[model samples]
Target: MANDPTHQFLVNKIVPIEIGGIDFSFTNASLFMVASAAVASGFLYLTTSQRGIIPSRMQSVSEMSYEFIASMLREGAGSSGMKFFPMVFSLFMFILTANLLGMMPYFFTVTSQIIVTFALALFVIGTVVLYGFYKHGFGFLKLFVPHGVPGALLPLVVTIEIISFLSRPISLSVRLFANMLAGHITLKVFAGFVASLGALGALGVGGAILPLIMTVALTGLEFLVAFLQAYVFAVLTCMYLNDAIHPGSH
Candidate 1:
């Protein structure tokens, strides 16, 4: 099963419980999700627990992370969007930690699951819609109408805008899910080749070197992708929130 790439994503019940008719089994994915949150929280707490004129290395890292997300929010949505800093920071840290954790051998990549990613995307868009409507009342609907479009083309443009608005969650979720899934699968395939080639005679062992090198290189690339995908998710999230903050901007 270690050789099977898809087997890594399979969710197994760690503790099974049933309530009335619904199954509430604690799964590997659930465990990893909790672990991701815990790890992120712990890191932040430990790093910033002490304050000194000259910050410790960990403290520097923690502060940098805070400023990074804060700057992103300010740039994307302006000062008004800073109110959602906690939400945005937590999202970035959780996803970043989860992606990095999954790179470890035997660790299950939670973000690779479409359902998990979709739920996150849904929460983000749901927040935007609820907050937008609450803040702007019916004025939020103005988002679908561009400022300078010709009257004849306004209806078509509005229809396109509505469709695009509706597709945000789908696009956001699939982008993260697909990148993680593809990277991990490719790594597993190359790893399998290394194992298979190394098991044979001297000639096969010699041939294994190339696949082994490729696997190592791919692992490094996957690490880069892990960070990049998290950043992309966070930035796109900020853009969406910006729309909510200023509903009628072009």
Candidate 2:
């Protein structure tokens, strides 16, 4: 029987060890999460261990990363965005690390899972809602109704806006999950070709050679995608935060 390449991304309980009816054993997914964090921490620590007036290469990279996120917040969320800089910075770093680490062979890609992405989306949406209410009280209700809509159209417009607002988490999670899942599956299918056809097949083997080359190219592309997806995720979060902080503003 052949393994279903599409379903290969599904999570499995590797240990399945139960304690008093509760599964407490660490999973491959959990392992990857810790590994991703450790790798990110180690890399940054090693690179930035030496702080100098002139700035070492590692320190330069760290400074550059900080500037990049700070600039993004300033542009997307404005100057007041600085107040939430720590939250935004941590989010970007964790996501960027998880994504980049997942590119390694045999490493689990947690972000490729809908559950993981959904959790992230839910957190972002929840933060926006909580903060909006905290900052503006019931006035945040104004967010659902645009300022210039006619009284007759206000109800309908508010209804639609509410629905769209509720769907943000779903859309955000699905976008990331679908992209990662599709890319990884395509890579796996092409890899299967190289293994199954490249040895004993006819010119099919030569055809497989092209896919082999493509696999290498696609691997590099996936790395870029990992970073890009993280950035997209962060940017969207900033946009949502902006909307929450200043509802009805252009």
lDDT of 1 by residue, 122-211 (tens): 999999999999999999999999899999999999999999999999999999999999999999999999999999989889999999
Off by over 4 Å in 1: none
Each candidate structure's TM-score, on Cα atoms with residue i matched to residue i, is 0.98, 0.91
Error (Å) of candidate 2 at residue 193 is 1.2
Task: Give the per-residue lDDT digits (tens) of candidate 2, residues 196-240.
Answer: 777767877877888899899889888888888888888888888
- How much is 178 displaced in model 1, in angstroms? 0.8
Best by lDDT: 1
